[model samples]
Target: MLELRPNCECCDRDLPPQSAEARICTYECTFCASCAETVFAGVCPNCGGNFVPRPIRPENKLLKDPASTKRQLRSAPCGARTAA
Candidate 1:
C-alpha cells in the first residue's frame, strides 16, 4: 500500500491524500509536481528513478489505511543531492 505521504519532501508543500499534484517514485519518495518537473526533471532525487503521479487513496479506504502524517521535510533542495 502507498504511504500517501502528506507533504512534498523537497519544498514542504502540503499534499493531502487526494492531491493530484503529488508525484512519487517507486521508492515512494514524494514530491510536488512542480519539484518533480522543474527541480528533478521527473527523476527521483533519492532513488535515481522516474516519477509518476501518486495515487489517491479513496476517502473511504483512507479511514482504514490512513495517509501518512509523518512529513519528510528536507532542509535542502532534493535536486542538490541527486542520486548517484
Candidate 2:
C-alpha cells in the first residue's frame, strides 16, 4: 500500500490523507500538486518516475489500514526532473 505520506517531500506542505493536491510516484514518493507541476515538472525527484494523483483511502477503511503519519521531507535541492 502507498504510504500516503503526510506532507510534500519537496516543499514540506501538509497533505492530509484525503488531499486532492497530493501526487505520488510509483515508488510512492509524495509531493504537492504545485511542486509536482511547477518544481518537478510532474516528475519524482527520488524515484525518477512520473507522478499521478494520489488515491484517497476511504475514511472508514483508514480506521483499519491507517494513512501514514510519517513525513519524508527532502533536505537537499530537488534536482533535475527525471525521465518519465
Candidate 3:
C-alpha cells in the first residue's frame, strides 16, 4: 500500500489524503506540483525521474492502515539523487 505521505518532501507543504497537488516521481519521490514543474522542472531531485501526481489512497482504508501518526515530513529518499 502507498504510504500516503503527509507533506511535500521538499517544501514541507501539506499533502493531506485528498490533495490533488502532490506530485511524485517513479520512485515515489514526493513534491508539490508547483515545485515539481517550476522549481525542479519536473525532475525529482532525489530520483532523477519525471514527476507525476501521486495517487490518493481511498479514505475507507483509514480504518485499516491509518494515516501517519505524526506530522513529520521527509525529502525524497536515496537511490537516484540528482543536482537541483
RMSD of each: 4.8, 5.2, 5.9
Tell me, by lDDT, which candidate is best.
Answer: 1
Lowest summed lDDT across 10 adjacent residues in model 1 is found at 75-84
Backbone collisions counted per model? 0, 0, 0
Where model 1 places Cα greater than 4 Å from the true spot, the runs are 79-84
Stretches > 4 Å off in candidate 2 = 79-84
User: Clashing residue pairs in candidate 1, if any?
Assistant: none
For every model shown, what is its TM-score relative to the native structure?
0.88, 0.88, 0.75
lDDT for 32 (candidate 1): 91
In model 2, what lDDT does residue 66 have? 91
Residue pairs that clash (backbone atoms under 3 angstroms), model 3: none
TM-score of 3: 0.75
Residue 16 error, candidate 2, Å: 0.6
Task: Give one digit per residue, the lDDT tens place, for model 1 in 1-84.
Answer: 999999888877889999999999999999999889998898887889999999888899999999999989666656554421
Candidate 1 vs candidate 3: the lDDT winner is: 1
Each candidate: what lDDT?
0.87, 0.85, 0.71
lDDT of 3 by residue, 1-84 (tens): 667677666667788877899898877667778778867888878758998788877789777976563443444452333322
